[model samples]
Target: MPLNEEEAVLLGAAWQRLAGGGPEAAAVGAELLDRWNEPHRRYHTLLHLWETLRAVDVLQGEAADADGVRYAVWFHDAVYEGRPGRDEEESAELAARLLELVGEEPARIGEVVRLVGVTATHRPEEWDADGKVVSDADLSVLAGPTDEYLAYTAAIRAEYRHIPDRVFRAGRSRVLRSLLDGPHVFHTAFGRAHWEARARVNMLAELDRLASSAPLDLPPP
Candidate 1:
């Protein structure tokens, strides 16, 4: 799908902020908008990118490199081919290439690229404050109110529509369990204060729902 009006506006704004108004930055934004508008996308669409950037802006005070975080937020899902780590890797590579084209400093471009891939695990070295900020912002949706969270779940299910229900539930349950088992779902202190409790509640509720569903062995059609 082509980028919608609101999405195009958001992309333009992000590019203007990052690129400081130029054709090269506009081209980079267009490339990212194309990926976010890909027909197969659901939850990882421009809406997600827009919301994530908003969240980052809200948390910018805590970031060691707000610029890098913003750049990463724009391109983190730029190559969502449905493979987890591979998708992040490819997105990071794209970020590097595009940032270089726009004449971003080598160090800043490296940081942006690293941040894009860092999302694959949502974990960073203890000293990586920027990584924590981006990770927490990316996952802020999990802690959103019930209605919004439900919508996010629906969108994600639609994105993976090809997967069988039973298989999807099992895989999703595992992902939720991993987060629940972790010491912290949102690494930053502000994130913990704002989202940790609610995220846990939501994840546990969803996991319970999955557990109660009937088992099936049929393959995806």
Candidate 2:
């Protein structure tokens, strides 16, 4: 179903707020593309946003508030300057303005903005189901089929193009290892059941490529 009027309004308001901040987030999909994804030529920019929303739709209660989800989408990558702290604060500030425009009750809007800040953590230890669902959606790209996974590897690498091959490889390997070594590849049953195993397979394949210095094909192993 197309997003209803309410959702469309809220989403547009949220996006407007993001654009007003002067980064032109919608132009090429937030800083995730320019600073990281573009630098690394990673495919996680708009495509990631699109797929995550699709996942959210299939999930029950997963939409929470389309506005809330929209807020998360804008702010999730808000903090991608290859540095930390700033993204969350900047996103929170933008959210504050958007909340004002949305005519959200001052208190509730503040709370929603804060939740957007929460996403800076990417994976919270404990949280509301809505936040978790959205977060899982953001990370779900990692859990896709092998070919999709390899594409992500390139995206991430493009983001870090300034780093030498050795440094980037080591760091990237560590990230993949951490995910692979984790007790759960995904936080929610939906993502775990649906995408975790394949994610692992793809991650391991990337790891192997790093270790062997071999050209990786789509989907690694």
Highest TM-score scorer: 1
RMSD of 2: 6.9
Tens-digit lDDT string for candidate 2 (47-163): 555566566666535445655665556555544545445866776776676556545567656666766665555564555666667667777777777665666777666666667
Candidate 2, residue 85: Cα displacement in angstroms equals 5.1
Q: Candidate 2 lDDT (Cα, whole model)?
A: 0.60
Structural similarity to truth (TM-score) of each candidate: 0.92, 0.69
Q: Give the poorly placed runs of model 1, Cα more than 4 Å off.
A: 1-10, 214-221
lDDT of 1 by residue, 3-108 (tens): 4788767667877887777788777777777878887787898888888988998899989989889999988998997788999999999988989988999999
In angstroms, how far off is 109's CA in candidate 2? 3.4
Score candidate 1 by lDDT: 0.84
Q: CA lDDT, every prediction?
A: 0.84, 0.60
Taking all chains together, the TM-score of candidate 2 against the true structure is 0.69
